[model samples]
Target: MKLESYVKLTFLSLSLFLLIACTSEEASKNKTEEPTKQSQTEKKKENQTSLKENIPNAPTNTDELIQYPGGKNAGKSIGILPEDEKKQVHKDLDEFPKITEDASETEKELYWNNLLYLFQEDYIDPQTVLEKWKMESFGSPDIEDPRFQFKENLNVEILLDASGSMNGKIGGKTKMELAKDSITEFSSSLPEGANVALRVYGHKGSGSDQDKQLSCESSEVVYAMENYEENNFEEALNKFNPSGWTPITLALNEAKEDMAEYNGDQNTNIIFLVSDGINTCGGDPVAVAKSLADSNIKPIVTVIGFDVDAKGQEQLRNVADASAGIYANVNDQKGLSEQFKSAQDIAEKWDRWKRDSLSDLDAIKVDRNFMILAFSNDWGRKRDKQNSNLISASDYLYYEKKMITKEMYNYLSDKRDEQKYLTDRSQEEVVSYLESINDKTYGEMKKSIEEKYKQK
Candidate 1:
């Protein structure tokens, strides 16, 4: 009986040992597989974090907005892309990201910046902005006379008012002193072969009413109409002083007689009247000025009011208007000098007109070429800037932010290329039009270009 009991106990112990071994092996297998699963989960989270860190957040402040380098908006912040371009982009792209209410600020800004890749400004026509070429001429160059071809005799008459008011000071110099200096400088600078005359009015008597008749009849040609000679012209300017009443009417009448030989049909006459006041003596200067302008000597009367009163300026302006001329007011020496400089420019142009017509034509060609080059370069720079901005946005959206799929990014690139192609075609058309008329006569070119491009 004892032997049978021992056998039963040993069998039970073996069965229990087998059950404990199976449980321990199963637990160890599960522990080993769990670490592998945990490692995969950790790696996925790390990859996602790295992607978010790769791109910086979009700007929130206006100062951080991207700038444009060229175009009408140069030196300004980039604005929202136009609705037309946005619509076109939307048409080509599928599954475009939406800015939901819950979207982060960075995400919203990123979407807006990406659309700037398609931003384009309206094309500006060069003809609407560029100035037409103006050719300076003396009388008409097409005249048959040889004298008119190279030089149309130019007569410049300087009518000086030596009224008592001319003694007033401006910029530490008397009005008469400033006038003499500016007149001397202007006369010295005149083109050779041009005639100049200096006529002084109201220099013979005092401003007193008792001497009004003598002052009114005092207009005299100090320097007869003749080619400018430095020593002789200086003597002429020194012959007068500020001492009398104004006789503007008498001066205009005498100027007509002084330039009677030089008719408008053969010469260009210009009169520069320097005055400190209106005609104090009883006479209608505006009527006389009109008569002088209508005479054989068609003079272009330019009046300079030197510190004149409002009433005096109005009277002088009326005289100039009646004579189909201009009136300028000057209160200082510098202002006076600038007025004379304008006349000097006209004289220089006359000097240039005396040169060979071929040289003048060459100058016109050079000016036109410069204009064309400037326009072409401007167009090219705007195109390059536009393309550069588009590509830069595309790179940021696709490579850095991963905001756009590769296919969508490529489609944007194609749109940029298409835009560039269209601009290039337009630029080519403008250049061709300009070059087509390059060889045309100055008159023809001026007329055609002005007719085409004048402000609407």
Candidate 2:
């Protein structure tokens, strides 16, 4: 019985040893799996990091594939181009065509990306060819200047002087008849969307206010585009004739009142004053001019003087000057008609009276526009001062003279806005100036300027 017990104990020990060996092998397998999974995770992390770093740098390699913004340098710096341009560049790059499977990867990629960037909205990289195009046809980037174009339609007021002189012959017809004929032509010549008015004076008489002063006036916005008739323009002109003395100031004032209610998108209000003379009946012409100079209802004063004497000349000049307009001196009655016709043609062809204004100082280059010292109204009063356009030393030794004024100082201010023709001088100043300057004609003042500039 003792021998049998010993053999059983030996078998028990062997079974325990085999079980421990199997457990050791299982642990080893688990240890090996942990390292293998760890290696895979590390590799994945490295790949993501590399991608993140490379995002800002475009690939130089031809074989490598990448996306770029359209209308831009994919591999280079982008500039000034807007969003759509960026996408276009990218699209063209994507569309670089492939000829065959064996084609070089660089060539194929280039072909595909180029076409893609050209057409696709989302494309980022653009090819070399697409970069050359520009948007100059769209005009200036400054849209403000272009938008100020006169509206398509216009409204015109032909304010004519039907004084006794209009009865005299011109252009094989009386000045009055010739003016009517031209007015008729202008009415007929206007575009489809034009509103025209005819205001005439001297239709009354020398003895009557309607004739010599203000009452003889008549007005009609005959072919108002709002109520257009092809022949209606001609019919309106049939009712004008010669009447009384030239009351220009009264006519203009009345015109402002007449046009008060007629508002439109385009502020095209014109006063075509055709007359033989200036203010003959009543009212102050210069004061009238001063009144209209800076007003919002500013009419473009185009004066045509028909056989106008010195008085006629002075009257027409004042009217034109005050309104910021052009004056034509026609010697003959026929010339008057032709001038009117020319004016009509000009009005028809150009939306604006002139391409740019004569007052546009820009047309006269600042460098050559003025001999500053001579133009000044103040000189040799308090001190003898001289100035060159550009300031420098030792020039005062030359002892030249210069005139200066408040207007001059304002003009030379560095920050003055260049877009406008004139400053916002007060109307009171203008009115006062007009009232005070009756004894001083431009010619007389100019003639005595040199003598007055010297200190007494």
Top candidate by lDDT: 1
Per-residue lDDT tens digits of candidate 1, residues 29-100?
Answer: 989999989866664443233122333232222111111111212211122435453333334322334222
Which ten contiguous residues of candidate 1 have the minimum total lDDT?
A: 62-71
Q: Model 1, which residues run further than 4 Å from truth?
A: 1-151, 357-456
Tell me the number of clashing residue pairs for each predicted model: 0, 52
User: Cα RMSDs of all predictions?
Assistant: 23.7, 31.2
C-alpha RMSD between model 2 and the true structure:
31.2
Model 2 lowest lDDT segment of ten:
128-137
Q: Encode model 2's per-residue lDDT on 171-248: one tens digit a residue.
A: 345767767766665666665555677676655555354443344343333333332354665665565556566667
Clashes of 1: 0
* lDDT of model number 1: 0.65
RMSD of 1: 23.7
> What would the TM-scores of all predictions be?
0.49, 0.41
Q: Which candidate is the best by TM-score?
A: 1
For residue 198, model 2's alpha carbon misses the true position, in angstroms, by 0.4
